[model samples]
Target: MKNCCQAPARRLFAYPPTSKTPTPSADDTVRPQPTPSKQNRGRPHSGRGTKRPAIPALPNFLPKLNPGSQLVMDRIYSQLLLFQLFFTGSVVDTIVKNTNTFARMRSEAGKHFLWLPLKAEELHSYIALVIYMGLLGAKNIIDYWSGKEIYRLPFPKSVMSRSRFQAISWNLHLCDPEDDRENSQKKGTQAYDRLFKIKPLYNDIVSACKTYFHPDRQLAVDKRMVATRARIGIKQYMKDKPTNWGYKLYVLADSACGFTWNFFVYEGKSSLATGKGLSYDSVMQLLDLSLLGKGYQLFMDNFYTSPCLFMDLLAKKTLACGTIRTNRRRDQRGTIRWLRDGKLLFVKWIDTREITVCLTMHMAYDGDAVLRRVNNPEREWERRRIPIPVAVKDYNIYMGGVDLSDALIGYYNVLHKTTKWYKTFFHFVDIVVVNSFILHQHLSKAQNKNPLSQKEFRERLVSELATQSSTSEPSTSAISAGEPCCPEYFGSDAASGRRVCALCKLSGLKVKTPMYCTKCNVPLCLVPSRNCFRKWHTVGHS
Candidate 1:
């Protein structure tokens, strides 16, 4: 009699047991095997040519784009959709308007040393700055903005002034005037909220992620540590991680494509907890409620896997597979039997190298077994005789999706080394960029075009987002051109107050003067040897 639920172990090494002692000794514990039912014997076996079930092909999750479109073009169009859904025009407008208000208030309050007003163009430039820094991999903000070693392929000289970039970096605010906790005395309200300032933007990013793409049948839940040494309350330390100190995020992503569908930031002790424990709560938080009852298989690691969690997921019609720790299993005795590495029975194969146990609501007989090679120091390596369970193999295959998402984020991470706690908010922006890139790749593939690589993707994305001049108001040079004498000269006036002189600014000269031509309305210095007014309105400086 054999246990129908467990597989019979197969022989490896092509040799009989060295000693002919009955495998189970008098003192050794033995599992109780059930009588084999006639129906169970009638089913197909796992041996060669045993008529195994065919694996169903995975469905394409990419939506169809217009035919004959180039990948970069499609990517640009797809980015527009992503921005609209996630970082909408209204959202940008609110940020810009509120930022301007905050800047004015700061200047009025004498907190700002320089009168740096936040403008729409600078906001665009700020986004571009983050992208440029991510792509270039600079040591610091200074190194990224310096022109000494610019990468010619993507970065051009003087794309933006370093001082202006620095100013924007210092003044970037995601919250509105009302939400700014500058003077709030509510102790408990602000104490635990790590992301209180940028909560709105964070919520919008999450909402956009949920709305933009639908995940595949298989999903993975895992934790990621965003590297930072900042003194924030939400900072977590995982000594095993390459980045040991940082903020932790629980991400739910598509297994096959690594598209992040939903995510939850792990705050301190007050956060939600499942009936089973913290790990269960994390899995539940990341998994969207609407995805239930869809037969989606969720893959996790030992930290979150337990028989109770599996049963809960099974009750919701969602299947789960993971490497479970010994103590977490409900059938501790049955699970321990599979932990020993060797042959179990004549028909069923068990190898402890791959899996301890694979749990499914129904029999996991739909997928095929996976081949694994075993290495021996004394002899040539050979494939293990016993095959790995399909559920176990699928769990191994899809388990890295969240890690893969983290890897992509690392290539162009927006979070930099900073003392400020709010830099964590910028990490979410990096997620948006990575998610948008994923959407672009899928949409491009649907159009049968080769998608842009991550490097090229960021280059194009930054250029597109930053190229637009602000239309809401005139630039600082125009206002600082100091009152155009006539309406005809308004076109030539420099709106940017930061502009010293058109030639001086372009020539990288340090000269500064406020004089301008009354008719042409162009800013130029009137120094004894360097009168630039005539050259400003003329055909050529020469």
Candidate 2:
């Protein structure tokens, strides 16, 4: 039997060294003969045909605009409007119902707690308060509601009571509790889903993200860590990531603005693996089939780059470029190797070190150079232009989209310290806010207006969500024909005849005042601390 590796070497050195010597030149200087070495070895012919294959032309990358995206852009003129796209009525109702059901279950199990059914309006306020807390970070959750002048945040207290917020956070559930038994029975089986607890909310959010915007020509795929210390099975630890401990998410984002177009939660071995390895399956899972064959360029890291994967992407009319591992593909030092198979180009180029890149969209080296500071013999650093591969240059430029998204999210992350694993939903809330802000910037540029910063966008969003009225009309009944029908407030001279203010009671405040509305015939507070009378007439009627 012959060694398989020796076949290439035997073919490379098939012609032996010749005994004949070259004649001297006119100056009687004999030219030296070139020697055969690894670096100067002649190019190997492609097995397909005698003619060298031409480099495939780069396809024009024009992303197909999603039809629904235009409708969303037209409808979303405000931060609240964009937010409502993700948190629709059905989404909020699901949260409200599940939270109430969980609280009821806990109450029935002898947990000593008051169980007031959560309303959709109150849930909105709760979410607003949570986002506010993230914006104004604190040392502790109770610090926002602290009585101390330095620690108190009036916005959170004004939105919802601290106790009520705590209650909702503690019992915030995504799925029905009764399904636990049925889920447990399927454990360790093929039907088991580790993410079933938050699957509905997760699916809804993912769908909304894909529906609202079409990504640009350049896109990047990578993984992010949502920091959490919870003792859950799905938690992962990545030493390379800034957040070493948390849930891992495979994300696909737009390279231009860092808009997260899609994401998949990593569930360890139980995740959807297509037998092609985790990295391959993760990229495939995050890619939208509708966006394929439309000339989009994808950039990824060495973890996801492979010959088979790049060829697969090329088959679908999508172009990709990424670094490869030495174990997966061999590299030679101080040499440039170009191997072409069909439309895919496999290049191994030497800069400071050898780098193997598999690409379908870029030439091996297009005379592009990048400036680098080098240490000279005098021990001084000098800027020098070094020739680089086009594929490597592009990979460096557009491969940080996921990292950019992670950085923006880290600015005002809403994920707080909580034992309840469902609280991870707050990470998704932060993602939604980041995506909305990116869209906001694009729309602002299109309309020739200045865009708000992420901080400003979140503040405006919190205000709208916290103060938005649940009902489009007034909760009060129409005034009768015989009623006073006047919409003004009147104060009685007798202060002793004070009654509980109607509007103040609804806002979790108890106040007694002699002021009454003439038309509605309801007692309302008129003091500076509690302006129930003016609020009732303004908000209740209008």
Candidate 3:
């Protein structure tokens, strides 16, 4: 009551400036900066500061991918695959730099070694993948990446240096040990074969496919006998090694994704074509954990339908389904006595404008019970010599064996023989999936079985994270431990629509910082509640 009349005068004057910098915001915050000229204004300005427009909306993004290249002819070809091929093309460019040593690549293969540096400071294999990516484009991969940051690295230059040949030899050692570790030979005889299992570029292709595909669905093994158009070196058969005039490509792949996992290219003459077998060790090496599951199925053409191998797959609690070549007689074959399951396995005779296909149902042994007994030495001691004709030839001489009912097999077989014919089928499938997506997109149009919408899937993933965030252990190297673990790159986290971290709900706008977590090497924002900082994503960070 005493100061009421004079209070206005007391509040009239304000205090002076405090400090130059403002206090830090929450750790999760990345507060926006002011306009360029207004950033450090000394006092209020009526016309001194430059005005700026509001920030624009960001674009949308999605993460995760499929596998394969060539746009996938049906299930066999896919976008993920094409993307990978684009990557592999980069790796191939690395190897192509030294192609002068390999006679097979002697002819100028268009812009020979176009993107490769005449000299590099790092191992060719050590070059950042991004560089190769830029080098390999639908039209010109090198020209595309020339202006990118990755090309500026000194590693590329070091790798191309003559002194770094040791590294090239070392890489080849990982793929094949046959190469000379510390020697240089004339152009015609250079040990390019020892440097890499596949042509360098091809390995890049393989790597590219793997990044996009989900996992190895089923493993397929097949033998390709390719007669050369030149005076090729002699080699043993596909399996047994001695010497021959032709070469064979033993390819192993993920049945579900059609990504080539392992391929062995061997050269031999016909006289040396005696007995050769595929490399079991190589096949095992190429197996990707993504493809391995608690339960899995394997497929093979006639070449790998060995009785011993069959028993092994069953022992591993996995199923091995393949065509049984008519030529190979089973040791002990009596089918009617015991059979477990039967299904229609499609058979394709040819690949052309019009494809010829048929479905066949074959009886398969149900080794589910006492699977051990199938390979029990005690049970099979007498079965080895017994003649079993359980396996028979298909109508077409080119194909024979147990006709697997899987339509995927038929599609893969046709696609593998030649890719052009299968693409049409793939496009048709894409349309069907797209239409299905559209139907799911409109909730009202959905049938009793509602398909998940993009929003729904995102919500589900978020919910799953919430539950996982609580139960996950505090330590023990769980990816989700530190910051929300890692945010999906190119997914909603990085998408343009909103600057919110899909994971923590923190506005990326506030925490403009992009600090990376030391443990996981991921952007710190990905950490869910920093389950490491627990609640920190909310406001705990001091």
Candidate 4:
């Protein structure tokens, strides 16, 4: 019995040989370990009664963007436009240099040249003049230079001489003669080709807009009238506009800030080949496919809103809200009149405008909830319900972007009759200024900075462009002792190739000098004894 008791004590110290799990002692707590199974490959183990929630499915429509995002788009566009202008200005400067040289050569050959070559500074001043004329509301160029009795201050003559200004304005060429001729030859098929004289500038501006500026969620498309009575082939007439007779411009602008992102002048049947007419082509041109899939919304009037168009936009992942004409919609059925006041109704049907089928969306507001002030019997104004369609309300709210852009342009438009082409050029300048201002406002809001007003911005821009530093003294130590030369001394190389130095020739001396100062870009005597480069640049030369 003593030996059996000793055996039981030995069994307590050793574990039993079985596949079952071991029992825990009273002092220890047992925790369960997860089993390796295919079903639990991706998921981690949770404690008992704890469950993970299923992830929700992505909806068909993207969430509406915040208002701040629109401002960001505007800001980006503005910077791009400015960058394009800088490049354009550089190219123009080079062209002007070459043209001036050519003109001088022609003049020397005793050939009559109509266009006088202009300097970059002069071009800058001309741009400033255009802006100044718009802001001052001057009737003509001469009027601005020549102050009227009512005018307290005249345009400073020192900024740009009137004659020089006129010459530059009249001869402002954005392209070479060869390109203009080539473009003019193809003008019959392309209405835009008629604007080939300034087509390069136009293309640059358009490219800048496309690269940098994107419209906000809500975009508006409409026709704008650039006021002018000039007889041009491309000019269009819109009877409804205040300026009924002017160029018809199809504008794509942001609904929030009225910033014009892209535009094209409506020329005629050729431009309207898209079958949807002026409205459709304009919208297609303005629409960026990259922006479409991001849930952008387009707002247009009856002219652009068609059943097929709406479906096309929706298919591309864009939402459109607009007013539609009865003929524009293909569906004739379910066109019910809202007898029940103040209710919004939707009608959906298959659109069969063309041979192919399309999707159609229609919404109507009974106008019962619309209110207007009324004069009561007590002779006091009171709010009263006025029925207006919901479509009308939405249209009125979003359709004003084009109107706003027009207003901004009209407030200080810079177009006049020098030539029809000049009118286009000035119009472009107006666009650049307005777009720049929009960008300025956007940046200010983004950075929490104070923005300059449009007027202030223009003034600063004009000052920077117009001011050229001609007084950068020559670094040559040899020319420090000479008398200051006349302004005419620094003029463009003379037409007469056989000419002598003005100083040397005036002294009744006949001396030839091949050495021309690269800095001054003028011919001067660089003889061992008589160095006119030193004399010309110096202040006390004979």
Q: State which candidate has the highest lDDT.
A: 2
Query: Model 3: how far is 261 from its true place, Å?
Result: 4.0
Tens-place lDDT per residue, model 2, 6-72, is 1122111111111122322234321122224552344443322222234577666656674224444
Q: What digit string (tens of lDDT, one per residue) describes model 1 on residues 499-520?
A: 3555565455766554544433
* Per-model RMSD to reference: 10.9, 11.5, 38.1, 24.1
Worst 10 residues of 1 by lDDT: 11-20
Off by over 4 Å in 3: 1-199, 225-227, 234-246, 254-259, 267-286, 289-291, 324-542
Residue pairs in collision within model 4 = 367-387, 367-388, 479-534, 482-538, 482-539, 482-540, 482-541, 483-539, 483-540, 483-541
Could you tell me every candidate's TM-score relative to the true structure? 0.68, 0.75, 0.31, 0.62
**Among all windows of ten consecutive residues in candidate 3, which has the lowest summed lDDT?**
5-14
After TM-score superposition, the amount by which residue 251's alpha carbon in candidate 1 deviates from its true location, in angstroms, is: 0.5
> Local distance difference test, per candidate?
0.57, 0.70, 0.30, 0.53
> How well does candidate 1 match the true structure in TM-score terms?
0.68
Error (Å) of candidate 4 at residue 258 is 0.8
- lDDT, candidate 1, equals 0.57
Runs off by more than 4 Å, candidate 4: 1-87, 94-116, 147-155, 186-192, 291-293, 326-368, 374-382, 386-390, 468-542
For model 2, state the Cα shift of residue 77 in Å: 1.8
Per-residue error for 103 in candidate 4, Å, reads 6.3
Candidate 3 shows a clash count of 66
